[model samples]
Structures are given as structure tokens and as C-alpha cells.
Target: MASSTITPASLPPAGQTSNFVDPPYIGGKFVAVNCIFLPLAVIALGVRTWTRLFVVRSFRWDDYLMIIALLLSCVLTGVTLEMLNWGLGKHMWDVPLADFMAQFPKLNLIAAIIYCAATGFTKVSVLVFYLRIFPSRNFHIAVWTIVFIAAGYSIASILANIFSCNPIAKSWDLTITTGSCMNRPVFYFANAGLGIFTDFATVAVPIPWLRRLQMPARQKVAVGVILAMGCFVGIVSCIRLGSLYTLLKSTDLTWATTDALMWCTIELNLGIFGGCVTAIRPFVRRYFPRLLGLSSGGGYTSSQSRSRKHGHPLGSIPHSDRVNFTNQDNQYTTTLTTLRGAPDNGSEEHILASHPSGHAKDADGTTGIIRTVEFDVENSSTAPQRE
Candidate 1:
């Protein structure tokens, strides 16, 4: 429900194409839906905290910043809507207690400023985060450049938010007595252009550089897909810009503003999603345990591994040719069932079945006890040894 005080003011005079715009929209679905997704995003973030703990993790800082920005933006939007709800009750409820907020005036645009700040701040934060994660010199310059441009534009937007209405309250849930905002379309257009371009820079900055990395075709595709995932958010940004126009042009803006808010919220939230997805190597392993294979990177202390093995369901792990056993303290041991680089025949099995005393510790921490599981990459898994 809208405020009674805001009803006549929220609308443009009949037969006129012009309208008095509220800085931030209230009593719309935009605020409601965004409130719901915020928590889920934060929860997704919490579950991924494990990656940060592993000493050999490959996570990045931008991942954390992106998550934080999403949460902050979500909360700020929620708070702004709550404020609108307060206004609605004050102006329309039977015995509302929020008249103080309604009467204080100037709060609409202030709320608008808060929402705008959250919007811009979230975008810029995500941009810097993307820049941080990618590997390129241009990525650095691009992040800083966009930081100055987008952040500076937000300041301009805040100024516009402040001066849009003469008495300020006029900028928010308007009344018939209120003075209308200044050149709303032009203001929106400038800000919209700045915002759209900033999103483009943010979304595009990493593509060229990522394209140049000398990786395997499969790995390059994986990286490309990850970086390109941001384009989905870019689409949302474009839609949000359209919504900005719908919001500016419509007087009865429940639908337009809701649509606009939804798109913008999605754009920002998707960015958060992108950030979190980048860190999903560990998360996917945690949530979908089967797909990731329950292994601790096999660096667990000997004692921890034993306890874990005892606690873990039997056969949950297939029997490897070799098994590692760790005792209390720093002692490590491996029992290998088969030797590597062996002949492709049963003879290889017999060689391991009746092996000689080839006792030796290689630099990679493997000894005669046998390292059954081998990740054949350059950084191969260490063979097991007797303590």
C-alpha cells in the first residue's frame, strides 16, 4: 500500500506526459523479492569458507568482497523498503505509529540515496574484485579506472538525489503541495549511461586477457566460460537500464519500478553469484560430496587421516592400489599396491605382490610403503612410506 500523503503526489497531473518522481520507490515487489534472496546468497557464502582454511587453496580475495557487497546491498535495500513500509503505514494505516518518519520529510530521497549508494557501491566493489582475480596488467588499470569513474558517478548521483527536489522531501513520496523534481529524464539518462558503461567495463575487462593465456583447450574453455558467465549479469544490467526508463516515465510505477528494481537487484545479485561461483571448486565438493570425491587433498596429518578413515563410511572410498596411513604427530606412511610406469599386464601386479626391499624416500615425500593413488600431473601425489 502507498502512503495517502503520497498518492496524489506520486502521480503526474492528468493528460500530462511529465511526472513528479520519487527518488526511491516504495510499496513495490522489488523490495520484497530482493530481501528474500539476500539471505540465501549469504548462506552460500558461509558454506564456502572452508576453502579459505586449506593451506593449499587457490581462492582469491575478490570472492570475499563480492559476497560482502551482495549482502550489504541486499540489507540496504531491505532497510530502505522497511522505511517505505513505515511511510505507508503512517500515511494510510488506521492507527499507525510512523508519523514521525512521515513528518520528518526529506527521507524519500535520502532513502533513494542510500539505495543508490548501495547499488553503485556493490557494482564498483564487484568490478574491483573481478580486476583483482584476473591475470593481466590492464585488469589492474581497468579496475582502478572504473573505480574512479563508477564511484565518482555515484557521487554525482548522490548530488542529484539531494538536489532533485527543493525541500528534499519533495524528492521522496511526494504530496500535492510538494515541488516536483528537476529534469528527471536527463538525470536518469546520464546516470544510466554511466552505470551501463561501468557494468560493461566490469564485465568485459577480463575477456581479452583470459583469451591469451596458454592453457589446454579444455582448461581455456573452462576459464573462458567462467569469465563469460558475467555476461549474464551484463544482460541484467541492460534490462535494469530499461527499467530505469520505465521508472522515470511511469507515474503509477508499482509495475515499472518493481521490474526495474528486480532487474537491478538481479544484476547485482548475479554478480555476487558470479563471485561465489568462481570459488565453487571447493563448494561443489562440499555440497555435492559424491561428485567432488571425499578426500582432504590427502595432506591430513597421519592421526587425522586414521580417525577420519575410521569415521568415514566403509567403501565410501574405493580401495586404492595403495593406502596412506598417518600416525600421531608428523609421521607419514603409504602402502602402495602397484608400482607406477609399470607394464600393462598382470605381470605388473605380480611384481608389486612380491616386491623387493626398495626402501627409499623421494623428494615428494613418497617411500617404499607405496603411493597407490596417483594424480599423474607434474605435481604428482607423494608415494606412501613406513614411519
Candidate 2:
């Protein structure tokens, strides 16, 4: 939730002053949140980049959108830090009236815009990543719908914040007395309310699709837990919304906004962290396979082997997993369905075994009568081919 600043029009009339007492300085809490979460976000995105580019060797639109989100997040974090310098977390009485009048509101306006853009891109990136992995047509439709809604919300938020005050400069420049502003509290509340709604909606979209996948119970549970961790972002948004309400109603904005701003940092950072989790599996499988109960080769385990023998495709792998079967003619038929525009053999394991002679070999050195099932919904009832 973006913190809403009280406009000068809400202040006391001429020859009057607020009776509110200055509260204890708690700006350090804001500083601490930024220091911790921003670096965590950077590290998460950095590892995600390495995992996608070097390990998986598949970089797509989702990654690009995440990069944009990160950039905007950094900009927002920087602006927030700059806000602290002008007494952002101090009591209104403590701040120099000029700094409070000019500097803080300017940065606040900028922060609101950047927050909207960053969050919008983050949600869209997660949805796009879903598109890359899940092949269900219905799921794709849901994801695309959410993408449009998120984009629309962000655009509306940016526009509203930009023109919240007619004669835009008046948004930050309290000296311009003639200009009027939209209901600042209502705008921020609606924006944050929609943000929280979308947060839960994005997390909910994958559940039904995941349940339909034919995976072992243990693996299914593990995968679900990983994705469910995204709920933390939604929870943070709720907390931020509460803090936002407190800040908007508060007479002491600079002091009361500390928690709201801190929660905002967490929400954005956790969004980045959540979006990167599934995509970084290849990196973990490569460097820390034991952590995931995977072997050094990053191939199917014994349970997966049993599942494969039954013609059930292991559900954990992404779209990039490729399988090749060599017929007696020594021609290879790749069975794994890859996403359009992705490199063949780009993701995780190359299930194709090479042989010295002109025949396909399994990993166990079986050189003849290779069996591989083609995964296609249309051909679901077809028997596995032995070649």
C-alpha cells in the first residue's frame, strides 16, 4: 500500500495550529526495512537471472518483465531513502515546513507512481511465467485475463496519481493554492484494495491446474508448498493496507507512515522473490541438488522412473525438458513438447542417450527396443512406441 500524504488544505486554517504532540522518532525502522528487503530482492533477481540464462538456457518475456520490475523497485527504494533525508518519518512539527511542503510530497508522488508500476509488472511477470510452464488452454486464458487487469490497474493508478491534483505541479507544490486535488485517501485506498485483490487472485489461479497434473503425492505437495509461499506477499499487502488506513487517518503522517512504507517494501520484494522461485529450480538442481533430494545428474528419480514406465509424464519439469527416441533407422523423434521459440534441449535434463553405434541407448546402456511415450492430450490413449 502506498502511503497517502495529507494535503495542505487539510491543515489548520489561518491563526490556528494542531494540538497533536510530536511522537518519538521511528525513522530507523523504515531504513532497516529498505536495507534488508532491497538487497534480498536484488539477490533473488540476480540468482534468477543466472538460473535462467546460464543454467536453464531459456530466457523469455517473463524474465524481461521481472527485470523491469526490479529496476522500478530500486528506483522506488531510492526515492524512499531520499524521503527519509527530508524528515519523512519525523513528526510534522519536527520537519522544516519548507521541506515538508515541497520535498516530501514530490518524492511521495514519485514513489506512488513507481510502486504501482513495479507491482503491476511483478504480477504480470508471474502470469507470463505461468504461461511458459503450464500448457492448459483454460489456465492460459485465466493468466492472460489477470495480466490485462493488472496492466489496467497500474495504468489507472499512475494516471490517477499523476493527475490527482489538477495542474499537476500542485500535487507536490502546496504553494499553488488555487489547484484542487482528488480525494487522496480514497484514491490510495482503492488502489491498495485492488492491489490486494489481485495479489490473492494471481496466487489462486494455479491451484486447479496444479491439481490436474499427474504427479506423485509427495512431489505434488512439495510443489504446492513452493507456490503457496506466494501467499506471504498477499499477507503483506493486507498488513500494508491496514497501515495505510492508519496513516491516512492520522494527523501525524510522517510518524505514522513508517509501518506503511516498510510494508510496501516487503510487498514489492516478496513479489519479486515469489516470481523467481520456480524458475530458479534448474540452478538449485545443478549446484545444490541434494537440497531438493535430487541426484547429481538432475535426472528422474526412482519414483519418477516408475511413473514414466507407466506412461505418466513427470509433472515437475518445465516445458523445456526434451526426450529423443532413435528408431532403427537412427532418426530421432523428440517427444517432449517445448514452448514455441524455446531452444531444443534447453531446460533441465537432456533425456536423450547417445551411443557409439547407430542406435539409441538408454542411460542404463540398453541399446535396443527403446520405448518412449509422446505426451499429447489429443493422443492421450495411444500406446507407447517401441523402437
Candidate 3:
């Protein structure tokens, strides 16, 4: 077997000394950050899954998609860490040429594919969540459009990465010496641009609907903040774009790509965090009411109070009697009259009427009133009776 070697002539140009031997290898930095972040991402997704399946019992499409995204993110992190052992995050020339050719491009290509899938699925999960909450036709159309765009971008990016080099093995095996690749930096920048666009779209699609929700000011703000959490993902994507630019411009491929990889990891994890945050609210409401300052009795919504007040002892209620009141001071009135034939056996006639006033407090601690009416009639004679 021939030993691999690099001569002085093979070194990067002047002012690119960082591509050669340098002190302070930073491969461990990727490992350390992944250790801290990957677990947190998994924990966030786990809590969300538990909350959806058990606490709320309303697990839907979004939850499953998010789980897929989490699994992909796990794969991405594992691949990224594996690459560190193969000379990622070091000066390029410091790596044995054979090891570099054998590992970096192949692992990077796999990571990029996983990255696109994970990000695309995450956006789908968020948009699916929005579809569940907002039923307007326009909102549904908008969300589906974005989902399609994300899917398209993911497919395009994966194909671009896979075919970036001819005789695909040449992508990783530089010694092949007879193949060509696409303009990699241009392809990377385009991919990053698409990622940033999708991130912004994911955050933007819900803002108008959030603003129109009829809720107390504090509740509105809380909902807005949660929905807007994707903004952090967008910010990280922008930073990742800058890192990609740096990686493209520098001859220190390993060192320059380190920042890009780090930012990508952060962006994906933050996206997972953002997706889980909304679903975890119910769990928080149940287990940590004080954390959100919610009353143990329940929220201030009138529907909840009405259900509590009028629900049957046998857990049945006349659906026809349901009322929705938008104004606290608004008064509603309903009357029921009933006629009955004489009972088979002699019995006394009876009539019962009840009026109840219910109080519901707003999230801001202001109180409101709800009124209820009930009536019951019993027949008394052995023979039939006519009005």
C-alpha cells in the first residue's frame, strides 16, 4: 500500500495558512455542543409527544411529522459528530488526504440531505398545526402552499447535493482526478437562501390570524409570542447563511465549515423547540398552572364555565341548549313550556323552575356573569287530560 502525502506545492495559496497545520483542533467543539443540544431537542420532542398523546389526547398529523423531524435531526447530529472524528473542524491540510477524501464529502452530503428533510418536515409540522387551529379557507390555502414550497425545496436540495459531483464517488475521493462537480458554493448559497425564505414564511403565515383572535390582551400576547418563536429559527438560518458564505470564501474548508455546521445544528434544534412549545402548553397548564398563572379552577373562557355549570350528572347535555356569548354584559333569555297527559297511576302534579347566575373571571382577573334556566314538569292524574 502506498502512503498518502501532500507536498509544499499542494498547499493552499498565500494568506491561506489556516488551511495547513494549525494549533487548537476544534473538532471537540462540535461534539460538546451536540452533547448539550441534541438531548435538549429530544427532550422537547418527547414532552410534546407525551402531552399530545396523553395529556391532551388530541395527537394529530403535526405531532407525527414533528416526530419524523426529530428522528432526522438525531441522524444529522450523529453524522455530524461522526465527521468530527474524520477530520471535520480542523485545518484542511492537517488532515491526512486519504482520510479527508474518504470521509468529509460523503458525510457532508448525507448530513445535508438529512438537514433538508428535517427542516422541511419541521415546517410541515408547524403548518399542519396552524391548519388545525385556523379553519378559514384562506389560511388553509396559504398553509398548504407553503407546505408544497417547502417540500419542493427539500427535493431540489437533496437532488442537487446528491448529483453535485460526477461519478458520485469522486465527490469524496479527490484522488480520482478525472471528474467535475457543480459550483458547490453557488449551490450551497441557493439552498441557504431557500431555507431562510421558508423559515420566514413559517413564522409569517400565522401573524395575521393571531392578531384577529378574540382574547384578553395578555392571552393574545402569550399566543403571539409562542407563534412567533419561529423567528429565532429564522435568525439562526440567516447566521447560517453568513457562515456558508465564509465557508465558500475560505480555503480552510474544515475550519470555515465548522461554523456553518454549528449554525445548522442550532437552527434545526431551535425549530424543534419552537414546534414543541405550542403543543406543550396543555401539559404546562395541567402540571404547572402557576408557571402560567392560570387558575386551578380553569381558564376564564365562558364556554368552560357554561359546561361546568350545566353539564348533566350523567355527563349528558342537550346540544340545543348551547349558547355562545361574546360580551360579558349581554343578556340572553329562553323559555320552555311543556304539556303532559295524565299518569297511569295517580300521582301529584309538580313543576320545578331554577335560575342560576354564574360568574367567570377574565384572564386579567375581571369578572363576568352567565345566567342559566332549568324547568321540569310532572303529570298527576290517572286519566288523560286535555288543555
| Candidate maximizing lDDT | 2
Estimate TM-scores for all models. Answer: 0.57, 0.74, 0.74
Ranked by TM-score, the better of candidates 1 and 2 is 2
Clash totals in order: 5, 0, 0
Write down the lDDT that model 2 would get.
0.73
- In candidate 2, what are the lDDT values of residues 258-369, reduced to their tens digit? 6777888899988998888867866766787666666665454233344432233434333334332221222223254322112222333334455567455533344543
- Candidates' C-alpha lDDT: 0.53, 0.73, 0.71
Clashing pairs in 3: none
Candidate 3 residues 6-95, lDDT tens each?
432125455654233453487777778788777888999998988877666566889999999999999999898888866787776566
Better of 1 and 2 by lDDT: 2
- TM-score: model 3 vs. ground truth: 0.74
Relative to the unseen true structure, what is the C-alpha lDDT of residue 341 in candidate 1, on a scale of 0 to 100? Answer: 28
lDDT of 1 by residue, 307-340 (tens): 2332211232344533323322222333323333
- The candidate that wins on TM-score is 2
User: Model 1: what TM-score?
Assistant: 0.57
